[model samples]
Target: MQALRIGTWNLASGRDGSGRSADAATLRAAVAGVDVDVLAVQEVDVGQPRSHGADQPAEVAAGLGARDWRFAAAVAGTPDPFRSWTPIEPPVLRGPDQAPSGPHYGIALLSRLPVRRWSVLPLGAGRAKLPLQAPDPRTGRNRWWWFPDEPRLAIAAELGHCTVVATHLSFAPHTALRQLVRLRRWCARLPGPVVLAGDLNLVGPVPARVFGAARLVSAPSYPATAPRVQLDHVLGPAGLDPQRPGAHRLALGDHRLVTVTVHPR
Candidate 1:
């Protein structure tokens, strides 16, 4: 059995807790310094103003000196200032140094191991209400609120040793449950030993039951200031002993990177 370190995080387009935008160097360090063999990233940007219109996934791969990476765009424009929109297309790998043709938002996976095949499966296309704590338009007071939902996606890459899947499920509770069911079925068809990682936007226990996979990490990963829930995760097929599963706190986003060490089945 070969051991591997897998990690997941919602990058929030590389914005730190203070709302400071990350540059190429900062982004690079975020990936390289994390010390994980494979990483699943969510809420990434491509040619979007919030993220300085950068091709984030590609940059991250370059930062890690990785040749294998895949990105799936779930929407066409930035979601900041939340408004309804549609995804331009499914996520695809950007060629080295290739510029984004338009602003896009999505999820990605970066790996030091070479990927043998790739596929992307999109979930619900309809809008769903997502609760948030934001400034109310009328009084500018910070309050609990709701916003237009974004498309969800699952991108999978078959590596030489294992297949890895990454995704960001819906924030809405009911919607998230449905997505989990779909995710389980989708993963079932992929080659094993499979590792699924990402900002699931749900509690740790929920997915564990559905996937029949061991939940390797359980630390709070969201609201970086005082995280109370484990929104990020790294899961492996059942009966696999995952060692040293934990979360790595960073000043880069509203999430603590979730990680685990597992031997491919």
Candidate 2:
């Protein structure tokens, strides 16, 4: 089979710090520049007031002319709908298939390649009060906000040649690791080589160690303007050949778009 370009990005509600949403034209241009075959996106808002109720998955697929896409909600309601929040949901383990119905915060996948089937898994429902830092809208003060619930999810799609899993783990290092362990076990059940992509939350050698896969791409992706740490990644099962220097960073959204090419067996 031919090689394919796959990418992962956390679109901050399809906007920048200026609180302006990019027009469809600009979004299309950005995706065109990346030239990816499959794209995994996180922090997508569905029917939320912030994103103008944009169906982010469908919008991006239309922009890229992708053949298929899927979206799964992690949280139901946005605490601060008008304002942006990092680690949007509270750190709680909700049912994998149970996201509060209606408008919510979530993740999605877009694939230009043909997808045979797909599935979703909700991991790490354990609740913890995490110290979330965000600017207060009224006071404009950067303060520590303790959020009570946070949830993580993993979505997998089986394309003709490979199975790609998209997920966003918790910001807490230990929690993220625990979810990764569950994800690994889940991926093992699928056929063919599995391509894992998304924001792992925990950076450095920890992801590589826990996943037991080759890190195909490694670059600063978070805080796009002045990225210092690598938070996004494209990982694949052992023996799958990843092209060196094929990984690239695209300037789009708050998190830089990271992509990699793998020769399909």
Q: Please tell me which predicted candidate would have the highest TM-score against the true structure.
A: 1
* Predicted candidate 1 versus true structure: per-residue lDDT over 86-157, tens digit per residue: 655544655454667788888888888877888888786546766777656668677886677788898888
Candidate 1: where is the Cα deviation over 4 Å?
Answer: 80-82, 89-98, 131-146
TM-score of 2: 0.83
Report the lDDT of model 1 for residue 195.
Answer: 85
| Model 2 residue pairs with clashes | 90-149, 90-150, 91-149, 91-150, 92-150, 93-125
Clashing pairs in 1: 72-91, 73-91
TM-score result, candidate 1 = 0.90
The worst-scoring run of ten residues by lDDT in candidate 1 lies at 88-97
Most lDDT-accurate candidate: 1
Cα deviation of 192, candidate 1, in Å: 0.6
lDDT, model 1: 0.79
In order, the Cα lDDT scores of the candidates are 0.79, 0.75
